[model samples]
Target: MQPDPRTNLNNELAQLLNNRIVEPDYKREITITFRVSSAEKTRLEQRCSGVVQSDYIRARLFDYPLPHPKLVIPEVNRQAIYELKKIGNNLNQQTRAINEAVKIGSQPLSSNVKEYLQTIKELAVLLEQTHASLSQPISDEE
Candidate 1:
C-alpha cells in the first residue's frame, strides 16, 4: 500500500531541529535544514522573503548581508538636541534676568510671568525626582 499524499506531507511537516556537534564557523558547511508544521513553515517563509530556507539560514548563521530586509534603528539627532539645549539655556538666562529685575523693583512681575515661574519650579522638582530615580541601581532593596 502507498502512503497517502497528505500523510507524506505531514511527515515533511515534522520539525527536524536536531544538530550534530562540529567545528565552529557556526556551521560544518553552508547548509542548514529544519522542518516544522506547515503553519510554522509559512510564518518562517515570510521572514526569509522567498530565499531558499537553507540559504537564508546560512546568511544568518554567518555574518553575510541578508537578502531580506533587516531591522533598522533610528539614529539620534544630536544636532537638534544640541540646539534645543542652547535654546533652553537662553530661556533660563532670560528668566533669571526677569526675576532679578523684579527683586530690585525695576520690573513689574505680571501674573503670567509668575505662572511661568511656578511651572518652571514644578518642572525642576520633576527633573530632580527623575534624576534620582535613574541614579539608583535597580536591584537595591531600599
Candidate 2:
C-alpha cells in the first residue's frame, strides 16, 4: 500500500503550510530525486515546517488583469547613446581583464580555455539545432 509520489508530495506540502504533519496515505516508501541549490534548500527549510524538495515549484498564474506599474522610456537619440555606453562599459571591463591576464603571462590557451571554447561551440551547435527545429513547419497529429 504505497501512495503515489505526486499525491504524497502534494499532501506533504499541504501539511507543511497548515502547520501539521501526516504520514503518507500508503505505508510503503518511494524514492524521488532532483537537484536543488544549497541556498534554495536553506531558504525553503527556514520558511517551511515540513518536507520540501526540488519537485515543488511555485508558480504564479494571472487569470485576471492585475495592475502593474508601467515604465515608459521615451525613445530618442539619448536612448541609443545609453545602450552604446552600457555596451562600451562591459567591453572595457573584459578588455581590462584580458590585458591584466596577459601581463601576468597566463597561458593563452590553457585547458580551461579549451574547455570554455568547446562549451561555446557546443552551445552554438545547440542553438543551430534549435533554430532548425523551430523553422520546420509543425504538423499536428490527428
Candidate 3:
C-alpha cells in the first residue's frame, strides 16, 4: 500500500512551522516592525550611545533601566585636562633636564623644581578625585 502524499506534505509543513515558531518566554526569536520620526530616531540613537538599537528599544519597551553612557567632560573638566597636560609636559622636560645633568655629572634638579614637582603631584591627585566624583552615580535623593 502507498503512503498518502498529502499526509507527508502536511507533516513536512508542520515540522517547518514548529521549527520557526519560538516558545513564549524564550530569548526573542521574532521580529517587530515599527516606525519613528527622523528626529525621534536621532534622539534615541544619541541616548543609546554605545548600545545596540534593538537592545535599547527593547529596554524602553519593557521599562528596563537603560545603561548609562560614558560621561562627557564638562567645561570645568576641560580646563583641568588642559592643566594636567601642561603639568605633564613640564614634568617631562624636568626629567629630561635631570637626565642630561646626570650624564654630565652635574646636579640639575633645583629645590624650586622639586617643590614644583610635589605641587604637580598634589594637583594630579586632586584632578583624579574630581574626575572620580564626576563619574560617580548621583542618588535620586540628592
Q: Top model by TM-score, which number?
A: 3
Worst 10 residues of 1 by lDDT: 15-24
Preferred candidate (TM-score higher): 1 or 3: 3
What local lDDT does model 1 show for residue 132? 48
Task: Pick the winner on lDDT between candidates 1 and 3.
Answer: 3
Kindly report which residue pairs in candidate 2 clash with one another.
Answer: none
RMSD of each: 16.4, 20.9, 8.7
Q: How well does each candidate superpose onto the true structure, as a TM-score? A: 0.32, 0.25, 0.41
TM-score of 2: 0.25
lDDT of 2 at 108: 80
What value does the lDDT take at residue 91 in candidate 3? Answer: 62
Off by over 4 Å in 3: 1-35, 38-68, 108-120, 127-142
> How high is the CA lDDT of each candidate model?
0.63, 0.52, 0.70
Q: What is the lDDT of candidate 1?
A: 0.63
Model 1 root mean square deviation, Cα atoms? 16.4
- Which structure is stronger by lDDT: 2 or 3? 3
